[model samples]
Target: MSATEEAMNRRIVLARRPEGEPGVEDFRLEAGPVPEPGPGEMLCRTLYLSVDPYMRGRMNAGPSYAPSVGLGDVMVGGSVSRVLASRLEGYVPGDLVAGFNGWQDYALSDGTRIRRVDPELAPPPAFLGALGMTGLTAYVGLFDIADPQPGETVAVAAAAGAVGSMVVQLATLRGCRVVAIAGSPAKCGYLREVLGADVALDYHDPNFPETLEAACPQGIDVYFENVGGAVFEAVLPLLNIGARVPVCGQIAHYNDSGNPLPGPDSLPRLMMWVLGRRLRMQGFIVGDHLDRLPDFVREMGGWLREGRIRHYEDIVDGLENAPAAFIDMLRGGNLGKRLIRVVPEDAAGA
Candidate 1:
């Protein structure tokens, strides 16, 4: 009936709005009795929880594409969970699912749009990543927005992270010369050696702009803007005429108070490039492309089965560690899809 009428639940709630960079203290661990499910509803036990850069934006008390995480509310996230109890017709106990279960140990759902997780196809984390929103975002941002052509050069910032890694794989398979940009040399190596990027460069290099120039001698045809800021400045000059830019994320500016980044060039310079190069740069929310979910699942599923698409996860154990994992991921401390294993694999009692 009410929140206090159900079983005990443990969760991470938003403690405070971050001023600049979000600190670990911004989240608070809370315990309360779980809300009971009514008719046409179900209770889900969280298995794997996602920690993303976008969550940092939600911690602020301001208007965004989505509503902000209210102070004392559960920190928002996507999770792979199992149905612990159900009053709905289709859902039953032990049915694995993927939904917006947040950082809590359990969730109460009215059985609206949540999808079942098929472990036979892929692992649970893959749904939170590659075969899920992360992969779809990469698909839309690269193929739909960027529209990269074969034999052309396509560059990606944050190239070793979840969406960025997928971008490199898709663009590379599409016959584009993929150049990966990342924060460290190890990530650069992973991009080049493992993901098959044609060229991988470290953005932390003092002469990064020059290095990017040398890598893309023929000029970049499509630029997947993930870590905007200094990366944006480096990409602007190397764009070819009629180049496409998918403004997916700006992780470099996520911690900024008001100003996203204080790079050498101004906004006026960016506008000039857009006008002069006939460039088309647009922002997107993957949720906007939900109509294509079936298509994504089929194709991405095939790719996964055939080993055409490979995914990675930087997994941390325990639900209590979720906040720290999220904080670390924001700082590029993780190498892949950062996730918290809220429950064990045998949590369903095998």
Candidate 2:
């Protein structure tokens, strides 16, 4: 059932493309009649909407790996929703699904983009976090790219984030020594204590480079690059020969205005280091790794059921607060996977 009896649909639209860090003013809240399902389509009520760093790039006017969210459009995102009215086979009212439902309260889908959610072992939000795309991302970036071996030294940045935290744990389970780098002392502590990272360093530390080097005395064999700014620079010299670097994201410069990197005479130096260190650095888009989704679901789902994997949601209450929550997440304000709860989950579980 829909959250309310009112026949209104509330949504946050992208009012403007941000110049630097996005502000609440960049998004506008508007309401209209609840949409009806067309032939072969279903109407879904959003339960939880994800606020990810990748959405920031889609807000820019220029082209990226994905198309930008046009002005006045419901912002692009992934959401866990419930089917309200269905005209399609294999779908019915009260069915939970995960889909590209954007930021709106209710959306219509043609059954092409929606996947039925199985909340038997975990909650619906897990379809958006660890047991979902986020977990798949960590699986692809680590095993497919870095190929961690037992006793190898793995260093991951943004270690407390949804993806990075998964990488930390996955690598640990593979018998690798994990070194985590996060923006704050708290995140560093979370990585060390909760995620079982061998050592966690604060990127804010002035002697971060020295401390990171000390943590991995055997040299970093796999460097999972997520927050790639100064953290990238600090980890460069510590790479062992034939090291693997999987560049998944660069959230550090996601909020920076203009060209993400300036004065790039450093490229020559980076090339020199790559040559000297025999490094293998490759950037990947998770979309390209979708083939591995089934593999991720099987392994990660088992881990979740067994309570071997830990997942967290730093949920912001209400649909109206989505924009503020998004802005705060890009600024390192979120503790775990940041999400906006549009409608509260059912007590019986969705």
Q: Best by TM-score, which number?
A: 2
Query: What does each candidate score in C-alpha RMSD?
Result: 2.5, 1.9
Per-residue alpha-carbon lDDT of candidate 1 for residues 224-280, written as tens digits (9 for 90 to 100): 987887888888999999999998788888888874544556767778888999999
TM-score of each: 0.95, 0.96
Q: State the local distance difference test value for candidate 1.
A: 0.88
What pairs collide in candidate 2?
A: none
Model 1, position 37, has a per-residue lDDT of 81
TM-score of 1: 0.95
List where candidate 2 sits over 4 angstroms from the true fold.
Answer: 1-5, 347-350
Q: How do the residues 38-97 of candidate 2 rate in per-residue lDDT, one tens digit apiece? A: 789888889999999999999988868999999999998999998888898889888999
